[model samples]
Target: MNVNRRLNVSEVGDVTVVRFVDRRILDEANIQEMGQELFQLVEEQGKKQILLNFAGVEFLSSAALGKLITLDKRVKSHSGKLILSNIRPEIYEVFKITRLNTTLDIKDDEADALAAFAALQAT
Candidate 1:
Protein backbone atom coordinates (compact mmCIF):
# COMPACT_ATOMS: atom_id res chain seq x y z
CA MET A 1 0.00 0.00 0.00
CA ASN A 2 1.34 3.46 -0.86
CA VAL A 3 1.36 6.41 1.55
CA ASN A 4 -1.42 8.94 1.23
CA ARG A 5 -1.60 12.27 2.99
CA ARG A 6 -5.26 13.12 2.56
CA LEU A 7 -6.72 9.63 2.26
CA ASN A 8 -6.45 6.32 4.04
CA VAL A 9 -6.39 3.65 1.36
CA SER A 10 -6.99 -0.06 1.64
CA GLU A 11 -8.41 -2.96 -0.30
CA VAL A 12 -11.27 -5.36 0.14
CA GLY A 13 -11.03 -7.93 -2.62
CA ASP A 14 -10.62 -5.89 -5.83
CA VAL A 15 -12.25 -2.80 -4.43
CA THR A 16 -10.05 0.07 -3.30
CA VAL A 17 -11.43 1.52 -0.10
CA VAL A 18 -10.52 5.15 0.53
CA ARG A 19 -11.27 6.99 3.74
CA PHE A 20 -10.73 10.70 4.23
CA VAL A 21 -8.01 11.88 6.60
CA ASP A 22 -9.77 15.07 7.57
CA ARG A 23 -13.20 15.69 9.02
CA ARG A 24 -13.57 18.87 7.00
CA ILE A 25 -12.44 18.91 3.37
CA LEU A 26 -12.22 22.67 2.88
CA ASP A 27 -8.54 23.55 2.74
CA GLU A 28 -7.43 24.43 -0.76
CA ALA A 29 -3.98 22.89 -0.55
CA ASN A 30 -5.21 19.69 1.00
CA ILE A 31 -8.00 19.45 -1.54
CA GLN A 32 -5.51 19.89 -4.35
CA GLU A 33 -3.28 17.18 -2.95
CA MET A 34 -6.25 14.95 -2.41
CA GLY A 35 -7.43 15.48 -5.98
CA GLN A 36 -4.06 14.52 -7.40
CA GLU A 37 -3.90 11.44 -5.25
CA LEU A 38 -7.40 10.40 -6.30
CA PHE A 39 -6.64 10.99 -9.95
CA GLN A 40 -3.51 8.91 -9.65
CA LEU A 41 -5.50 5.95 -8.39
CA VAL A 42 -7.19 5.54 -11.76
CA GLU A 43 -4.86 7.38 -14.15
CA GLU A 44 -1.53 6.06 -12.93
CA GLN A 45 -2.22 3.22 -10.51
CA GLY A 46 -4.88 1.46 -12.63
CA LYS A 47 -7.46 1.05 -9.90
CA LYS A 48 -10.76 -0.16 -11.39
CA GLN A 49 -13.08 -0.09 -8.43
CA ILE A 50 -13.05 2.68 -5.83
CA LEU A 51 -15.13 3.06 -2.70
CA LEU A 52 -14.94 6.44 -0.98
CA ASN A 53 -16.16 5.98 2.58
CA PHE A 54 -17.00 9.36 4.01
CA ALA A 55 -17.40 8.07 7.54
CA GLY A 56 -15.18 10.74 9.13
CA VAL A 57 -16.03 13.71 7.01
CA GLU A 58 -18.41 16.32 8.36
CA PHE A 59 -18.07 18.99 5.71
CA LEU A 60 -16.69 19.55 2.22
CA SER A 61 -16.19 22.68 0.16
CA SER A 62 -17.31 23.17 -3.41
CA ALA A 63 -13.74 22.73 -4.54
CA ALA A 64 -13.64 19.38 -2.83
CA LEU A 65 -16.86 18.46 -4.60
CA GLY A 66 -15.32 19.50 -7.87
CA LYS A 67 -12.43 17.15 -7.29
CA LEU A 68 -14.84 14.32 -6.62
CA ILE A 69 -16.62 15.05 -9.85
CA THR A 70 -13.36 14.95 -11.71
CA LEU A 71 -12.33 11.78 -9.97
CA ASP A 72 -15.60 10.09 -10.92
CA LYS A 73 -15.09 11.05 -14.53
CA ARG A 74 -11.52 9.81 -14.57
CA VAL A 75 -12.53 6.54 -12.97
CA LYS A 76 -15.29 6.07 -15.53
CA SER A 77 -13.02 7.00 -18.38
CA HIS A 78 -10.83 4.12 -17.25
CA SER A 79 -13.91 1.85 -17.30
CA GLY A 80 -13.81 1.85 -13.51
CA LYS A 81 -16.57 2.35 -10.98
CA LEU A 82 -16.74 4.79 -8.06
CA ILE A 83 -19.01 4.43 -5.06
CA LEU A 84 -19.50 6.76 -2.07
CA SER A 85 -20.64 5.53 1.30
CA ASN A 86 -21.18 6.56 4.91
CA ILE A 87 -21.94 10.15 4.12
CA ARG A 88 -23.27 12.27 6.95
CA PRO A 89 -26.77 13.65 6.60
CA GLU A 90 -25.65 17.23 6.23
CA ILE A 91 -23.14 16.37 3.59
CA TYR A 92 -25.69 14.14 1.88
CA GLU A 93 -28.05 17.10 1.87
CA VAL A 94 -25.43 19.08 0.04
CA PHE A 95 -25.12 16.34 -2.56
CA LYS A 96 -28.86 16.17 -2.94
CA ILE A 97 -29.13 19.92 -3.27
CA THR A 98 -26.43 19.95 -5.87
CA ARG A 99 -28.07 17.02 -7.67
CA LEU A 100 -24.81 15.13 -7.40
CA ASN A 101 -26.80 12.30 -5.93
CA THR A 102 -28.05 11.55 -9.41
CA THR A 103 -24.62 11.81 -10.95
CA LEU A 104 -22.69 9.71 -8.45
CA ASP A 105 -23.29 6.28 -6.98
CA ILE A 106 -23.93 6.60 -3.26
CA LYS A 107 -24.93 4.18 -0.56
CA ASP A 108 -25.89 4.27 3.08
CA ASP A 109 -22.87 2.33 4.28
CA GLU A 110 -19.74 0.53 3.20
CA ALA A 111 -21.50 -2.79 3.23
CA ASP A 112 -24.08 -1.55 0.78
CA ALA A 113 -21.43 -0.08 -1.44
CA LEU A 114 -19.53 -3.32 -1.43
CA ALA A 115 -22.68 -5.19 -2.25
CA ALA A 116 -23.28 -2.84 -5.13
CA PHE A 117 -19.82 -3.56 -6.43
CA ALA A 118 -20.42 -7.26 -6.13
CA ALA A 119 -23.68 -6.86 -7.96
CA LEU A 120 -21.91 -5.14 -10.79
CA GLN A 121 -19.47 -7.99 -11.07
CA ALA A 122 -22.24 -10.55 -10.97
CA THR A 123 -23.88 -8.85 -13.90
Candidate 2:
Protein backbone atom coordinates (compact mmCIF):
# COMPACT_ATOMS: atom_id res chain seq x y z
CA MET A 1 0.00 0.00 0.00
CA ASN A 2 0.93 3.69 0.01
CA VAL A 3 3.54 4.78 2.54
CA ASN A 4 2.13 4.44 6.03
CA ARG A 5 2.00 7.79 7.76
CA ARG A 6 1.61 6.58 11.36
CA LEU A 7 3.44 3.27 11.26
CA ASN A 8 6.39 1.47 9.85
CA VAL A 9 5.42 -1.89 8.40
CA SER A 10 7.74 -4.78 7.77
CA GLU A 11 7.75 -8.52 7.48
CA VAL A 12 9.62 -11.05 9.62
CA GLY A 13 9.19 -14.53 8.25
CA ASP A 14 5.44 -15.09 8.02
CA VAL A 15 4.60 -12.35 10.46
CA THR A 16 3.93 -8.70 9.71
CA VAL A 17 5.87 -6.53 12.13
CA VAL A 18 4.47 -3.06 12.76
CA ARG A 19 6.04 -0.19 14.71
CA PHE A 20 4.41 3.06 15.62
CA VAL A 21 5.74 6.30 14.20
CA ASP A 22 4.16 8.29 16.99
CA ARG A 23 5.26 7.79 20.58
CA ARG A 24 2.14 9.39 21.97
CA ILE A 25 -1.02 7.97 20.48
CA LEU A 26 -3.47 10.34 22.13
CA ASP A 27 -4.67 12.57 19.34
CA GLU A 28 -8.17 11.72 18.22
CA ALA A 29 -7.50 12.42 14.55
CA ASN A 30 -4.30 10.49 14.49
CA ILE A 31 -5.92 7.55 16.19
CA GLN A 32 -8.49 7.25 13.44
CA GLU A 33 -5.86 7.47 10.79
CA MET A 34 -3.87 4.82 12.57
CA GLY A 35 -6.91 2.61 12.81
CA GLN A 36 -7.53 2.78 9.10
CA GLU A 37 -3.95 1.94 8.31
CA LEU A 38 -4.02 -1.05 10.69
CA PHE A 39 -7.25 -2.32 9.19
CA GLN A 40 -5.84 -2.00 5.70
CA LEU A 41 -3.00 -4.32 6.61
CA VAL A 42 -5.49 -7.10 7.36
CA GLU A 43 -8.32 -6.26 4.99
CA GLU A 44 -6.47 -5.37 1.82
CA GLN A 45 -2.98 -6.73 2.40
CA GLY A 46 -4.33 -10.02 3.74
CA LYS A 47 -1.79 -10.23 6.54
CA LYS A 48 -2.48 -13.02 9.01
CA GLN A 49 0.29 -12.87 11.56
CA ILE A 50 0.63 -9.35 12.92
CA LEU A 51 2.96 -8.14 15.64
CA LEU A 52 2.83 -4.59 16.97
CA ASN A 53 6.11 -3.43 18.49
CA PHE A 54 5.49 -0.71 21.03
CA ALA A 55 9.07 0.00 21.98
CA GLY A 56 8.83 3.71 21.20
CA VAL A 57 5.25 4.19 22.21
CA GLU A 58 4.89 5.77 25.65
CA PHE A 59 1.21 6.69 25.64
CA LEU A 60 -1.89 4.96 24.32
CA SER A 61 -5.34 6.42 24.56
CA SER A 62 -8.52 4.48 25.19
CA ALA A 63 -9.64 5.24 21.67
CA ALA A 64 -6.44 3.64 20.46
CA LEU A 65 -7.19 0.62 22.59
CA GLY A 66 -10.60 0.40 20.94
CA LYS A 67 -8.92 0.26 17.57
CA LEU A 68 -6.70 -2.58 18.80
CA ILE A 69 -9.71 -4.50 20.08
CA THR A 70 -11.31 -4.14 16.68
CA LEU A 71 -8.11 -5.13 14.95
CA ASP A 72 -7.91 -8.27 17.08
CA LYS A 73 -11.41 -9.21 16.04
CA ARG A 74 -10.63 -8.60 12.39
CA VAL A 75 -7.53 -10.77 12.60
CA LYS A 76 -9.47 -13.60 14.23
CA SER A 77 -12.17 -13.36 11.62
CA HIS A 78 -9.55 -13.92 8.98
CA SER A 79 -8.05 -16.80 10.93
CA GLY A 80 -5.00 -14.72 11.71
CA LYS A 81 -3.05 -13.83 14.85
CA LEU A 82 -2.08 -10.53 16.49
CA ILE A 83 0.54 -9.99 19.17
CA LEU A 84 1.83 -6.90 20.97
CA SER A 85 5.40 -6.51 22.16
CA ASN A 86 7.80 -4.28 24.07
CA ILE A 87 5.15 -2.29 25.85
CA ARG A 88 6.61 0.06 28.46
CA PRO A 89 5.41 -0.45 32.03
CA GLU A 90 3.43 2.79 32.13
CA ILE A 91 1.53 2.07 28.95
CA TYR A 92 1.17 -1.56 30.01
CA GLU A 93 -0.53 -0.54 33.21
CA VAL A 94 -3.22 1.04 31.09
CA PHE A 95 -3.74 -2.24 29.32
CA LYS A 96 -3.82 -4.03 32.64
CA ILE A 97 -6.37 -1.64 34.09
CA THR A 98 -8.54 -2.04 31.03
CA ARG A 99 -8.16 -5.84 31.22
CA LEU A 100 -6.72 -5.80 27.69
CA ASN A 101 -3.68 -7.62 29.03
CA THR A 102 -5.85 -10.70 29.37
CA THR A 103 -7.41 -10.42 25.94
CA LEU A 104 -4.44 -9.37 23.86
CA ASP A 105 -1.43 -11.61 23.44
CA ILE A 106 1.43 -9.52 24.80
CA LYS A 107 5.08 -10.39 25.07
CA ASP A 108 7.99 -8.93 26.99
CA ASP A 109 9.96 -8.18 23.83
CA GLU A 110 10.06 -8.61 20.07
CA ALA A 111 12.13 -11.78 20.30
CA ASP A 112 9.66 -13.34 22.70
CA ALA A 113 6.78 -12.30 20.52
CA LEU A 114 8.33 -13.82 17.41
CA ALA A 115 8.99 -17.02 19.28
CA ALA A 116 5.40 -17.11 20.43
CA PHE A 117 4.28 -16.71 16.84
CA ALA A 118 6.51 -19.59 15.83
CA ALA A 119 5.13 -21.67 18.65
CA LEU A 120 1.66 -21.03 17.42
CA GLN A 121 2.68 -22.12 13.93
CA ALA A 122 4.15 -25.33 15.34
CA THR A 123 0.95 -26.29 17.04
Candidate 3:
Protein backbone atom coordinates (compact mmCIF):
# COMPACT_ATOMS: atom_id res chain seq x y z
CA MET A 1 0.00 0.00 0.00
CA ASN A 2 1.13 3.55 -0.72
CA VAL A 3 -0.12 6.71 0.89
CA ASN A 4 0.06 10.03 -0.91
CA ARG A 5 -1.05 13.35 0.55
CA ARG A 6 -4.46 13.13 -1.08
CA LEU A 7 -4.77 9.44 -1.93
CA ASN A 8 -4.42 6.18 -0.05
CA VAL A 9 -3.52 3.46 -2.52
CA SER A 10 -3.84 -0.21 -1.65
CA GLU A 11 -4.28 -3.54 -3.34
CA VAL A 12 -7.22 -5.88 -3.01
CA GLY A 13 -6.54 -9.14 -4.79
CA ASP A 14 -5.57 -8.00 -8.29
CA VAL A 15 -7.28 -4.64 -8.06
CA THR A 16 -5.74 -1.39 -6.92
CA VAL A 17 -8.04 0.67 -4.74
CA VAL A 18 -7.31 4.37 -4.33
CA ARG A 19 -9.10 6.13 -1.54
CA PHE A 20 -9.17 9.89 -1.39
CA VAL A 21 -7.92 11.35 1.88
CA ASP A 22 -9.35 14.79 1.41
CA ARG A 23 -12.95 15.66 2.07
CA ARG A 24 -13.05 18.17 -0.75
CA ILE A 25 -11.08 17.36 -3.89
CA LEU A 26 -11.42 20.87 -5.29
CA ASP A 27 -7.88 22.01 -5.92
CA GLU A 28 -6.60 21.85 -9.47
CA ALA A 29 -3.05 20.88 -8.50
CA ASN A 30 -4.25 18.14 -6.21
CA ILE A 31 -6.62 16.88 -8.85
CA GLN A 32 -3.86 16.82 -11.44
CA GLU A 33 -1.57 14.97 -9.06
CA MET A 34 -4.24 12.41 -8.34
CA GLY A 35 -4.84 11.86 -12.02
CA GLN A 36 -1.14 11.42 -12.71
CA GLU A 37 -0.79 8.96 -9.86
CA LEU A 38 -3.70 6.92 -11.13
CA PHE A 39 -2.33 6.98 -14.64
CA GLN A 40 1.03 5.82 -13.35
CA LEU A 41 -0.65 2.89 -11.70
CA VAL A 42 -2.06 1.85 -15.03
CA GLU A 43 0.72 2.83 -17.41
CA GLU A 44 3.80 2.16 -15.29
CA GLN A 45 2.69 -0.24 -12.60
CA GLY A 46 0.52 -2.34 -14.94
CA LYS A 47 -2.35 -2.19 -12.53
CA LYS A 48 -5.22 -2.25 -14.93
CA GLN A 49 -8.02 -2.99 -12.50
CA ILE A 50 -8.68 0.10 -10.41
CA LEU A 51 -11.29 0.88 -7.83
CA LEU A 52 -11.64 4.46 -6.60
CA ASN A 53 -13.22 4.70 -3.17
CA PHE A 54 -14.89 8.03 -2.60
CA ALA A 55 -15.90 7.47 1.01
CA GLY A 56 -13.97 10.48 2.28
CA VAL A 57 -14.65 12.77 -0.62
CA GLU A 58 -17.60 14.99 0.10
CA PHE A 59 -17.09 17.57 -2.62
CA LEU A 60 -15.34 17.61 -5.97
CA SER A 61 -14.82 20.40 -8.44
CA SER A 62 -15.51 20.06 -12.15
CA ALA A 63 -11.78 19.80 -12.71
CA ALA A 64 -11.65 16.72 -10.53
CA LEU A 65 -14.45 15.16 -12.52
CA GLY A 66 -12.59 15.89 -15.71
CA LYS A 67 -9.53 14.15 -14.35
CA LEU A 68 -11.61 11.12 -13.49
CA ILE A 69 -13.04 11.00 -16.98
CA THR A 70 -9.59 11.11 -18.47
CA LEU A 71 -8.40 8.37 -16.16
CA ASP A 72 -11.39 6.27 -17.13
CA LYS A 73 -10.50 6.60 -20.78
CA ARG A 74 -6.88 5.79 -20.11
CA VAL A 75 -7.84 2.61 -18.31
CA LYS A 76 -10.27 1.60 -21.04
CA SER A 77 -7.62 2.19 -23.67
CA HIS A 78 -5.46 -0.32 -21.82
CA SER A 79 -8.34 -2.79 -21.96
CA GLY A 80 -8.65 -2.40 -18.22
CA LYS A 81 -11.47 -1.74 -15.79
CA LEU A 82 -12.17 1.19 -13.48
CA ILE A 83 -14.78 1.24 -10.79
CA LEU A 84 -15.94 3.76 -8.17
CA SER A 85 -17.35 2.89 -4.78
CA ASN A 86 -18.68 4.42 -1.58
CA ILE A 87 -19.61 7.63 -3.31
CA ARG A 88 -21.51 10.17 -1.24
CA PRO A 89 -25.05 10.76 -2.47
CA GLU A 90 -24.23 14.33 -3.42
CA ILE A 91 -21.22 13.25 -5.40
CA TYR A 92 -23.11 10.41 -7.02
CA GLU A 93 -25.76 12.88 -8.02
CA VAL A 94 -23.14 14.96 -9.73
CA PHE A 95 -22.08 11.97 -11.84
CA LYS A 96 -25.67 11.30 -12.69
CA ILE A 97 -26.29 14.89 -13.66
CA THR A 98 -23.21 14.96 -15.81
CA ARG A 99 -24.32 11.69 -17.46
CA LEU A 100 -21.13 10.04 -16.33
CA ASN A 101 -23.20 7.52 -14.47
CA THR A 102 -23.85 5.85 -17.79
CA THR A 103 -20.22 5.87 -18.82
CA LEU A 104 -18.64 4.88 -15.49
CA ASP A 105 -19.06 1.74 -13.44
CA ILE A 106 -20.05 2.70 -9.91
CA LYS A 107 -20.75 0.36 -7.02
CA ASP A 108 -22.30 0.86 -3.63
CA ASP A 109 -19.37 -0.38 -1.56
CA GLU A 110 -15.86 -1.73 -1.71
CA ALA A 111 -16.97 -5.31 -1.46
CA ASP A 112 -19.32 -4.99 -4.38
CA ALA A 113 -16.72 -3.29 -6.50
CA LEU A 114 -14.14 -5.93 -5.71
CA ALA A 115 -16.62 -8.66 -6.43
CA ALA A 116 -17.38 -7.08 -9.77
CA PHE A 117 -13.72 -7.17 -10.62
CA ALA A 118 -13.46 -10.77 -9.59
CA ALA A 119 -16.40 -11.63 -11.77
CA LEU A 120 -14.83 -9.92 -14.69
CA GLN A 121 -11.60 -11.80 -14.23
CA ALA A 122 -13.41 -15.11 -14.04
CA THR A 123 -14.97 -14.57 -17.41
Evaluate all candidate structures by whole-model CA lDDT and list the values in order: 0.96, 0.96, 0.90
Each candidate's TM vs. the true structure?
Answer: 0.98, 0.98, 0.95
Cα-lDDT of candidate 2: 0.96
The positional error of residue 108 in candidate 1, measured at the CA in angstroms, is 0.3
Q: Which residue runs does candidate 1 get wrong by more than 4 Å?
A: none
Clashing pairs in 1: none
Number of clashes found in candidate 2: 0
Better of 1 and 3 by lDDT: 1
Ranked by lDDT, the better of candidates 2 and 3 is 2
* lDDT tens readout by residue for model 1, 45-75: 9999999999989999999999999999999
Q: Candidate 3: misplaced stretches above 4 Å?
A: 1-3
Q: Tell me how candidate 3 scores on lDDT.
A: 0.90
Alpha carbon lDDT at 8, candidate 3: 85
**Deviation from native of the Cα of residue 66 in model 3, angstroms:** 0.4
